[model samples]
Target: MTTSIEPGPSRYSFDNDDPESVGRHSHLSNILDPFTFQRLGTLGDLAGKRCLEVGAGGGSVARWFAEQAGPTGDVLATDLNVRHIPLDAGFRVLRHDLVAEPVPDGPWDVIHARLVLLHIPQREAVLARLAESLAPGGALVIEEWATEFGNLCLAAPDDEAAGLIDEYRDTLVNRVLPGRGNDPAWAARVHATMLANGLVGVDTAIDAASWPGGSPGALLIAVNVAQLHDDFIAAGFTEERIQRLYAAVQDPRLVVRSHFTYSTIGRRPGGS
Candidate 1:
């Protein structure tokens, strides 16, 4: 097991109290989480099952797991820097570093990670570790954004604002990512990775959605624009341009289309 943390690209904060982070959390819990649960719910009840939730940001999903597992099952919600989460007897939080160690304890019935592996330098190793942690007949679910420029776009384009948005996006892609030039399309390979790592019944899907003026995605992106204003300035973007794009994101007439979100699910063979 690797005892050292792998250096990676600059990560966007998932801080619990920060407004931007809160907005992003709301976006996930209110919008994306339901969509995810709908898919996983089809797999059947989680009652009495142990779940492992990686990168448990605000712990919304962790809470969901606890509710589904009821009082009988338990969940281990972990992150490097956990802030706020509603907890219960069945749910517990741990400050864990995936790169520095293997899963604390598992043979987990369900392992789910969202937007986590893409930021980690040792993603492949981490995936192997997660695979190993799954119990026979367990399920692993992973989701990541195919986060590239062309993948995300402003639906109601304002040429002027578009230019600024492009500039900010470019800075993130070129200057800010904290990894060793890892593939941006890594999420696209998740299904294959899980299959190769000794999983079966692998399946994959992609989703795209429109963020209308006041939608969670809009709010989240608006937060992102404000959060990274300083970075954009440091990257040679003008304050005026950045401010303009920020305003545009908040405009009710503006529509933003998120990049395609990719998800994969695989199961360990055997009865739980």
Candidate 2:
């Protein structure tokens, strides 16, 4: 017999007294910035449509969606953990787990999730839930990182450090995060998953962009590397090895290439 675990309270409810530490640790804002404008563009017009944003970390995307929907439209943002949400007139932030909480009643014109599904082990189940919440003709958008984007390189002369970074990368792509195991093929799989679950007019688009040379990109990459380095050390890698990896990553000659994929705009069968 399969045992079902009761869903716990919202995963996003952080302590009000610890906002500073929480904000510093929250990488969702930086990690999500690159795709914000692009995601909005992909969403098309939503001048007066109800919208749901799942995993609206820090309310960045939620704010954007609220702006697009205007006062006439409503945007409900939900996440397992409630951090800092900017005060906005029409935006409503809720502490709810998409898997457990009933999706707010929606014949929503649009629903979107970005960089959110990678952490979810139950991708198919979540997609099914999102699909069911849609009104006929409603659009569902999902974007995820492809495993192929896990490229990290260091110009350091120390081969040992490079090796360690590689190992950490493997862990990050395969184990550290729950469903990131399917990173490379996540978009394609999601496409099929949605269709299989009864969505129609499915379409997918892959976005590939380079970080090139910029402090913003460099800083973000360095922070991510540092996080991975800490994880590696915790997982038995030596401190020296982690240091060496960071050194190589900081080298000017090493160019890191990341490729991201997105599957946007699947529709519920029948017109709303």
Best by lDDT: 1
Residue-by-residue lDDT tens digits, candidate 1, 24-91: 77777776786678767866899989998898777878888888997788788877766544444358
**Residue range with the least summed lDDT across 10 consecutive positions in model 1:** 1-10
Candidate 1 whole-model C-alpha lDDT, 0 to 1: 0.74
C-alpha TM-scores of all predictions: 0.88, 0.77
| Distance from true location, Cα of 241 in model 2, Å | 2.8
**Segments in model 1 whose C-alpha atoms lie over 4 Å from true places:** 1-19, 88-90, 149-151, 178-183
**What is the Cα-based TM-score of model 2?**
0.77
RMSD of each: 4.7, 6.3
What residue runs in model 2 are displaced by over 4 Å at the alpha carbon?
Answer: 1-36, 148-151, 154-165, 178-184, 212-214, 225-231, 247-251
Error of 1 at 164 (Å): 3.0
**Candidate 1 clash total?**
6
Per-model CA lDDT versus the true structure:
0.74, 0.63
